[model samples]
Target: MFSLYVFHLTPIQTKNPYPTKELDFYSILWSVLFVKLLIYFLAFITY
Candidate 1:
């Protein structure tokens, strides 16, 4: 799932990279947190 997130962002990150490295780093962090939250939500719903 983590690899999937990285794979999904690669193209968009390459094509329209963030203006600042700090913002880019934050975006990646946020995306990872979001993905983890989403996974937990889905698992909770199903379990």
Candidate 2:
């Protein structure tokens, strides 16, 4: 999970190649939120 978070934070070359610092940050944020929601869903089900 940590690796996945790091992976999303890493920069990648897009087709347009228009570099932007915010892209990586947003990706990491989305990844974290996704994991958090998944965990919450699982806990809800178990409870």
Candidate 3:
């Protein structure tokens, strides 16, 4: 299961052939995480 997960994740984490799309996927993933963290921080401050 873990290996399967890593296999699915490898394209985004590594740049072997399809770099552009994978990089875009990574950027979108990071952006979502950043937005979630920002929202959590703001909520904590307000609370």
Candidate 4:
């Protein structure tokens, strides 16, 4: 599921022509944290 979500973002990220490396790095970091929280939420719901 996590891989699928990241895979989905790949095209969108590439499509953005702006080459702000730092901003992209930060956004990716935030996305990883968001994914972790989402996974935790889903696990809690399942439990």
User: 1-47 in candidate 3: lDDT tens per residue?
Assistant: 33544565576567556567867776677667666877887899999
What do the candidate models score in CA lDDT, each in turn?
0.74, 0.65, 0.67, 0.75
Query: What does candidate 4's lDDT look like per residue over 1-47, in tens digits?
Result: 66766775676577775567955875687688878989898999999
TM-scores of all predicted structures: 0.59, 0.58, 0.61, 0.56
Superposed model 1: Cα runs more than 4 Å off: 1-19
**In model 2, which runs have C-alpha deviations exceeding 4 angstroms?**
1-19
Error (Å) of candidate 1 at residue 12 is 18
Which sequence of candidate numbers ranks them by lDDT, best first? 4, 1, 3, 2
lDDT of candidate 1 over 1-47, digit per residue (tens): 66766786676667665566855776688697877888898999999
Q: Which candidate is the best by lDDT?
A: 4
Candidate 3 accuracy as TM-score: 0.61
Kindly indicate the candidate among 3 and 4 with the higher TM-score.
3
For this target, which candidate reaches the highest TM-score against the unseen true structure? 3
Q: What is the C-alpha RMSD of each candidate to the true structure, in Å?
A: 3.9, 4.6, 6.7, 3.6
